[model samples]
Structures are given as C-alpha cells and as structure tokens.
Target: MAKETKNFVLRLDAQTMEAIEKWAEDEFRSVNGQILYILCEALKKSKRLPKTKNEPTKSNT
Candidate 1:
C-alpha cells in the first residue's frame, strides 16, 4: 500500500525562503522536496521516526 501524507500551509520570511531556494537548487531538488528532506532529517536525528521493516539495520549488511 502507498503511504499517506498530510498537507499543511507553511509561512516563511522572504530572506529565509530565498536561502532555502538556493540550498535546494544547489542540492538539485525542488523547494518542497528540500523542505521535506530537512524535516525528515531533523525527525530522524531526534529519534522521533522509527525505523521501518524494509530499512536495513547496521548489522544487516
């Protein structure tokens, strides 16, 4: 089955938006994709996102 995603509106300052746009371009990703990537990284760092069955653990390979 496909994963479900929730959508919400986000607001940011013009300067911050421009910085994100540049960072996204540098990383060869869309602005939205970059934001999602950053959020996912933060969640992982904080241990808020649990590992899924499909993901390989450090000892698996």
Candidate 2:
C-alpha cells in the first residue's frame, strides 16, 4: 500500500532543535521519523485518527 505524505518546513529554536536531535538519536530514528512518531502518538491519544482495519479493537466487559 502507498501512504501519502506531505512535505513542509518547520522552524525551531536552537535549544528545541538540540533537544529533538538528542531524542531522535536516542530512539535510533532520524529527526523527521521521531517527529512523525510523536505526531501519530498524539493523534491516537486524542482519538483524532480514524479506525483502521489493522488496528485491534478494545472490548467492554
């Protein structure tokens, strides 16, 4: 399956950039990958992402 992605420019302060770089390195992912991971997690936490077939469903007992 092909996933579509959009490219955009982001500006960060020097300290913020340094922090993100360190975090990315620790996670063994590129800065962009780390950013994307964080964004997806936030979306999931906020229930903003639509349900997908591959995602497991939770049952209420």
Reference-based lDDT, each prediction: 0.96, 0.91
lDDT by residue for model 2 over 1-61, one digit each (tens)?
A: 8999899999999998899899999999999999899899999999998988777778622
Residue 5 of model 1: what lDDT?
A: 89
In the range 6-51, model 1's lDDT, one tens digit per residue, is 9999999999999999999999999999999999999999989899
TM-score of each: 0.81, 0.83
As for candidate 1, its clashing pairs are: none
RMSD of each: 2.3, 2.2
* Winning candidate number (lDDT): 1
Worst 10 residues of 1 by lDDT: 52-61
